[model samples]
Target: MPTLRRTHPADLPPVQRRELWAWAGYDFANSGYTTVVITAVFNAYFVRVVADGADWATFAWTLALSLSYLLVAVTAPALGAWADLRARKKFLLAITTAVCVAGTAALAACGPGSVALAIALVVVTNAAFGTGENVIAAFLPELASEDGMGRLSGYGWGFGYVGGLLILGVCLWWIMAGAAAFGVDASAVVPQTMLITAAAFLLAALPTLLVLRERARPQPARSGLWRTSFARLRQALLESEGLIDLRRFLLCIVCYQAGVMTVITIAAIFTEQALGFSTTESIVLIMVVNVTAAVGALVFGLVQDRLGHRPTLAITLVAWLAAIGLFWFAEDRRLVWVAANVAGLALGASQSAGRALVGYLCPARREAEVFGLWGLAVKLSSVIGPLAFGAVSWASGGDYRIAMLATSLFFVAGLAILATVDVPRGRAAARVADAAIG
Candidate 1:
């Protein structure tokens, strides 16, 4: 018999590389929807135009965000467990992606004075997007080894920011020139922009469906989705004596992610309402942030491998605290631009590091189930952070600066918890778990 040859690390097969790109492509595809629909264009448009310029616009927008996340928080873990047990991550991802694309397209019909329709669409689309995020993340450990996981996760995040920038640029150009260049009426600009967003998401996501393959084996049948999910979750939390570090690390993510998500959800509105930025200026600022964020994700992702996930995350959280401080003190509109870039760096690094850490810590057999819990932590933050920001804004009579500063406490709290996590211990535990399962 002929001797088999071992492939070296530097000589990974082209097939593997292609699959990696396809995985990253999903991030690129969905980011367009996030940047234009959720983060930048439509969010502002909904508050300014669709809501008829209500005094409570900021509160209402944050409330809607909270509700959408609440839905995700309640369902993500059960769905994740079900997908894992059934070997259906790719199938479910497709269904959720379709929901996001369709709901985004329907926003074209939500003209001004369609606040109810706009809210409904945002809620549905956001929930779908959040679910897709969790499912897509479940593929991370399968795509790259732990040694290179940081780089791969970072690449995905970097690609996502690039996609966000490209889509935001397209929408900005349309808004600036649509009336004269495309014969679009000013009244129809926002609605038409929603159509553009939907198209971008649908087109960009095609590669993921074509190229990405599921690697999970179907687990034994369980009594029910919720029962299996809860049992597995409980096992990971309580029965596994070695997962204490994992448990602590997840709690840390919940605290810091609250600050991170609040900043992302509110950045556009804060700039528009407090600093008086025009629609074009706000989009441009976000574009600049995206450029820096892509750079940050790539740079910090490499750094994460060398410095280790815990140290890298702690540094990112400090950056977050400083950025929030700048937002609180920024009076000149230009100063807000500076803060935006700082926040962008922290945003990319923290997210990339967090995902890599979880990929490192989770057992291979439990990728979907564990990442589902990760999604749960993130969704829970979405609910708490936005609600807290909205409440502060409402209580302060819409003093968004105070509300923004309040987010710092979450970063500080998370960092305190992160300092205690033993990275090597957690990783060893995960390996042991994987061995037992194997």
Candidate 2:
């Protein structure tokens, strides 16, 4: 059985190489859901076909996503606490994965004018996906030391994009190539698209379920789940008062991740509506972006470890601002392509850097609890960014360009907060917290 190296309290959890691969595999498994359902096919499909291009289509889509993120924000801390205290991260993760897979597959039953059905299913799938994202991430510290965290995160993210690209390729082939020959219209293949994502998610998730070990030792039950977890959360927050740098970092995450999440949720919608990209072209563009994002994840992961996490994240945020500027004024498809690739590069780097920074600052034996708070910050940003963008579009009669351009404010806000975070101090605080654990 795998065991932690306890020569020192500050030492990281011991992880087998294969187990690390299994851990990364969960990232791979879940990416297809995001790439297909949220980014490429389903969002646009819902906006255009399911809602019949109504003025509120965009708003409705965003609302579903916003509600899901809000649910995660509300529930993640409690879930994390429960999982950690019970050594049931795997069990909870499995439940979430099952919900996501089943919910995504159920989307196949949604068709034209099935807006309510589609929205409801999307909420279930996305909420499950978002919560599971945090649960899986709680294992990061067990797999790598501080120095290696960025690289490990980057590897997983890179592999995730590869999963996304693979699924997109399948989607493109089925929609543009195979379906036409089978006397099937593109719209008729929507069920096929949903099924593909669900199957892929189930298949890819198996490695993590089968091979990854649950390493946390169970603590005795303190009380009922809600009260106990909330009590733990309150205590963690009190202790975190001394870790001011970590507090600042969470604010940074909320601001920057807001912009990033906005782009992820709506880029395809923008291109299709503003740039007149057909579904095929949209898929192609996203596939290319996924490639660039993979490269950015790997390159920036290495750079952050050598150059310092704060600087790495700062560079990416600046790049995000620049990319958003280009996107704001992009009137031609070529220019949109340029803007998107730039955003893609920044997207991968910023996500990798931020996650690694959190892991670096997180206290030992409290991965689930602290990361739950991390999840709260991220999900709150998700709620704010997308809901704000959707509100703008809805208010302006679907003036999507104005809404798209407005996301830059989030990046600016994130940078302002990020500058205040002291990475070294946060790391030191975490170490002290770790050493104090008895």
Candidate 3:
């Protein structure tokens, strides 16, 4: 609902390159939680070991994961609103990072079938991760010049992918050795992984704190920031029709990203179930994908900058459709290997480009709030893909193929909506200020 004012790059307020990198730095740290703990190691542990003996236990854990994301989806927009009004982007990021770290560290205490503890820690950690990402997302425009936005975002994704891969590799080694040499319990492996992940988060966040500089502009000081944010959110919802570019973008994101989310959430499950890969094998496969995705992020980031965000996004959507089709038709072990490579290349590109596109459309003053709404789309999609997959799986007596096919529809639909979105006028924020004064 809010409109962005334009400015000139040369006249824009000063921001150092190190500061930009630092703003992007959190990705390096938080991604480990995503890669090593949540997606690769922890999720597998929960299904394979923690809930191994009980069907009901697995069901309950699944339900809890869904509910946790639902809570995040509900709260994220308002949190973003508060960030925008209060100008607490950095502070909010710190708080969310701490929450993620603390939650991850607590996983060290969880034993097999410690379902309640596992669920609680995961929920807190995931919510923190989601919220922190939104705060960091708002910092993008602050970090880079208008010309640099795409590249900087891409660099962040590339760095994040590398960071995640590094940690996943370390965890995988320990997991394999622990299981093989000592008859080690899965609980022991998980706790150590959690500690390492938590530590990485804290370490990764330091560069951002030390280097990223955000000169907060003045806003009318509101007595109730949260309440005001909620009111603004309501206004945004009501004015949705006028935000044609943003609205179209959101619709496309919902469809395309649902498929992307489905693939990300299910990659490990797919590899294990369909290809008969072991935990180590699956983790290795994911590591390969993520590491490659970092490279893809960097490449696409450059491409987006050169050609503009929308064209690059269309390229990614096409790649996604092809990837899904490839995955669907994959049969031989060799083909599965090829599919992993394809997924790795496009996964991070989609996210980096999507986030940059949002940055372009969002009003400067309301950047954080808009990013929060974006987060809601993403987290809600996380819930949808899993639930849809679960339902289809259940109906088909555990056949996952149909669910995957359904996911591809999202790509096609997303591509359609994305095609309709025209890029907003590219003008620096500082120029607008100078013009007003003149």
Candidate 4:
């Protein structure tokens, strides 16, 4: 297995406050993309307008996202290894961010009967977003101590929700203004939200580009970058007994993150379809949910660092299960709102804790590559979870309630796998691996 020659954990560079915030800037920058385009505005628009409410529209949307995820799952691991080898996480971060911004901007051209244009743009934009997400997360272990990693990650994630809120809040105001002032309907104004989100992302990413420095030293260039990456990744996974716990935890991530992604991809559309929420109502619901999620991530970040990553994560999983149950039996919009809030609370913590735990278990010098693998795991869940939910909905003739309830199985599976992991042991193994590589 490839590993970095490095000093002990305490000997690493001290975290700079400016750099830390800049690092978090990427999170803040990108949340708007996911929140506005995929979760809040565009997905519903594609189904209701782009496809003109076709029966297969929901499935098609999920397929588009899953296809992007599939491409990431195939490419990110190798790219991660390349970034680690070349010390190019930031450079690659720039490329992916640009791709996402341009792709999201391109989404504005899609209106009714522009399903192909919409799906194609979504695929490119989301793929770029997912890839960049991996590269940015690779910075986590470099910037914070194991004890503080969860808290730091939470800060970024929680702050990211605020970013999402800003963009969505703006979109809401714009939609209302267009309705009242120009007498335009949502369909006419929705395209502008895409432009708004893309511009916000570009602005938000500037801090990270300017201030967040790359700490990983480049490896000696070797023959065949792709081959080297895959070989190293394969060797590491196959031979590193130290990472066994991390491997198990990855399985847990796959299961639970599926549930997370499913909810995110379907939130707005489900709200409108199942509970009679208008676009305005769905935006309001998600805005409130984002607030709760922000609180959850920040509070749980400290709690995880104090109580331990595993227990805190377990708590969030329990919350997810409860939320799923509530949504399943919800007979009214009020009940659905309750469930959405419950889910919002779990959303950030579950994702933040999972990523932090992976960082904890990762050996020195393997941050990007492992996170790439982590991205692969997450994208795989993205492919499976949302696609599964959409499939169930399609198969059941749009029985979205049953589809939503069935998602509980993912969290349950994640909980069962999570029980088997030993957190302290994993961290110890990582330290030992770093020393061994050195």
Best TM-score goes to which candidate?
A: 4
**TM-scores for all predictions:** 0.94, 0.94, 0.91, 0.95
Q: Which candidate wins on lDDT? A: 4
lDDT of each: 0.85, 0.86, 0.77, 0.88
Candidate 1 ranges with C-alpha deviation above 4 Å? 1-15, 182-187, 222-226, 238-240
Q: Write the per-residue lDDT of candidate 4 for residues 1-438, one digit (tens) a residue.
A: 112122234645555788878887788899999999889888888988899999888778888998999999998989999999899999999999999999998888899999888989999999999999999999888887767788888888898998999899998888788777878776888888889999999999999998887888878656677788889889666875667888889889999999999999889988888888988889999999999898888889878888899999999999999999999889888888899899999998887888888988998788999999899899999989988887788799888889998999999999999999998888888888778866
- Candidate 4 wrong stretches, greater than 4 Å: 1-14, 221-223
Pairs that collide, model 2: none
Per-candidate clashes come to 0, 0, 7, 0
After superposition, candidate 2 runs with Cα above 4 Å error: 1-13, 221-225, 238-240, 394-397
Q: Model 4, residue 97: what's the lDDT?
A: 98
Candidate 2 lDDT by residue in tens digits, 1-438: 222212223343456788778887898899999999999999888987899999788778888998999999999988998888888998989999999999999999888999999999999999999889998899888777677888888888888888999988898788876677888778778768889999999999999999877878887665776688899788776665656787788888999999999989988887877778988888899999999998899899888888999999999999998998897888777888899999999988998888889888988777888889899999999989888888787788878888877888898999999888888888898888878763
By TM-score, the candidates rank as: 4, 2, 1, 3
Cα RMSD (Å) per model?
3.7, 2.9, 4.0, 3.4
In candidate 3, what are the lDDT values of residues 1-438, reduced to their tens digit?
111122335645667656666766778888999887667888777776667657665466557667777888899899888777777888888888888888898888877768888888888888888888878988876656565678888988999999999888888777667766778764466667878888888988888876765555535546576678888778665664445577578767877877787777667777787668977788888988987899889999888878889999888888887777787788777887787788788788989999888877766677777788888888887788777777777787877777777777878888888878877532333234224423
* Candidate 3, residue 281: how far the Cα is off, in Å: 0.8
